[model samples]
Target: MNKVEMHHTIMAAKARKEMTWDHLSELVRKAPVWLASVCYGMNSASPDVAARICEVLELGEDVAIAMTEFPVKSWEKTVPQDPLIYRLYEVVGVYGPTLKDVIQEKFGDGIMSAIDFSMHVEKIEDPKGDRVLLTLNGKFLPYRSW
Candidate 1:
């Protein structure tokens, strides 16, 4: 199965099982965000992790194999339309330069490594309304002078 097929199959199975990412994370001992990313085909899983995911989801070998394959990691060039996603894009668009300046000031001339990154999502309860908290942690790779 290809990534699209695997994603569909996994999502179907998950819905049928009435399973949440947090539940799956508890079962598989992985972060819910990371596991969800793997399921969404944005990231690849190791062979063992793929097998574990398939086993928990009661999926077949094809899905497991597909999960282990590397992802293309491409997205549409246009701005995202989904409200939440679009807001995130908007935040970056508004604060991208500010963030760049602050990060550069602290870390020097370099970039954050998405390849070596971890993200976490948290819900903060409040009387007014719940708030979403996202933490993005990445290694700072300074540019090397050649």
Candidate 2:
């Protein structure tokens, strides 16, 4: 199966099993966000991880093999309409320049490495409303003079 087919199969199995990403993470011993990304075909899984996931989901070999393939990692260039996703895009649109300036000042002429990154999502409960917390951690890579 291809990545798209793999993602659809995984989602269907997950929904049928009524399994949360957190539950899958506990079973597979992986971070929930990363695990979800793998399921969504945004990231590749190691052979062992793919096997473990397929075992838990009762999926066949094709799904596991597809999971192990590297992803294209591309998204639409247009602004997202989904409220949650749009809010994140808006945050980057507004703060990107400021973040670049601050990061450059603190870390020099370097960029954050998405290849060497980890992200976490958390929920903070309050009387008013619940809040979402996101933490992005990436290695800093400085430019090399040629």
Candidate 3:
């Protein structure tokens, strides 16, 4: 599958795993909202964030390495860009809702902002086949009313 398709496939699979924002967030002492943002592809992962995410997901180091290869800049010119990068935009725009729904259901009104977040994607070989491991870490900011 192409990047966009691959992105969706990954998301759908993760969603099916029934992973909640709190479950993943609690793994790394990050905010559910921030983690959600990374999952939905609205933000990029920094190195420190990636390491923390790996720690929480128990995904190990290999996959964590690929994940840090993020922050890809696709568009930054006076004109359009390649079709590959374009797919990323589409994937994010469309799947964003799905990610948000899952996060809200798990964390209530809070959100996983990318302001302080990180991610890591790696491939691991299992008996069945190779699996892609993803880890995300963000600051856990509990929402409150003043």
Candidate 4:
């Protein structure tokens, strides 16, 4: 099957098995977000990671192979409509400049490398409500003048 087809199959199987991305990440030995991205066809998995994911999900070797294929990350919308996603877009819209300014002050004319980034999501307990904490770690790449 193709990557998108395999992604659909994976999602269906995950739902059928009542599996969480966190649980799958543990079995696959990859980060939860990264694993979710892989399953969403936004990222590729390594051979070992693909094997583990297939084993855990009881998927075929073909699906595993598809997982190992490189992904073409694309999105149709510039402004997301989903509330959860829109909130993120809003945050970036509001804070992106400040973040860039701060980063440049510290790192000096550099941009954060999404190509070499790692992220984690955590839940913090509070009396009001549980808070979602997202930690993004990326290498800083300073601009080089030739």
lDDT of candidate 3 at residue 110, scale 0 to 100: 77
Q: Over the stretch 24-134, how does candidate 3's per-residue lDDT look in tens digits?
A: 777756676666555444444576775776555554454345445554535465333667567656666788899778877877767785557666556799999988666
Off by over 4 Å in 2: none
Model 1, residue pairs in steric clash: none
Using lDDT as the measure, which candidate wins? 2
**Lowest lDDT 10-mer window, candidate 3?**
1-10
Q: What's the TM for model 1?
A: 0.98
- In order of appearance, the predictions have TM-scores of 0.98, 0.98, 0.37, 0.95
TM-score of candidate 3 against the unseen true structure: 0.37
The TM-score obtained by model 4 is 0.95
Model 2 lDDT per residue over 1-146, tens place: 98889999999999999999999999999999999999999999999999999999999999999999999999999999999999999999999999999999999999999989999899999899999999999999999999
The Cα error of candidate 1 at residue 143, in Å, is 1.1
- Candidate 1 deviant stretches above 4 angstroms: none
Worst 10 residues of 1 by lDDT: 111-120
C-alpha lDDT of residue 129 in model 2: 98
Per-residue accuracy of model 1 over 52-141 as CA lDDT, tens digit each: 999999999999999999999998999999999999999999999999999999999999999999999999999999999999999999
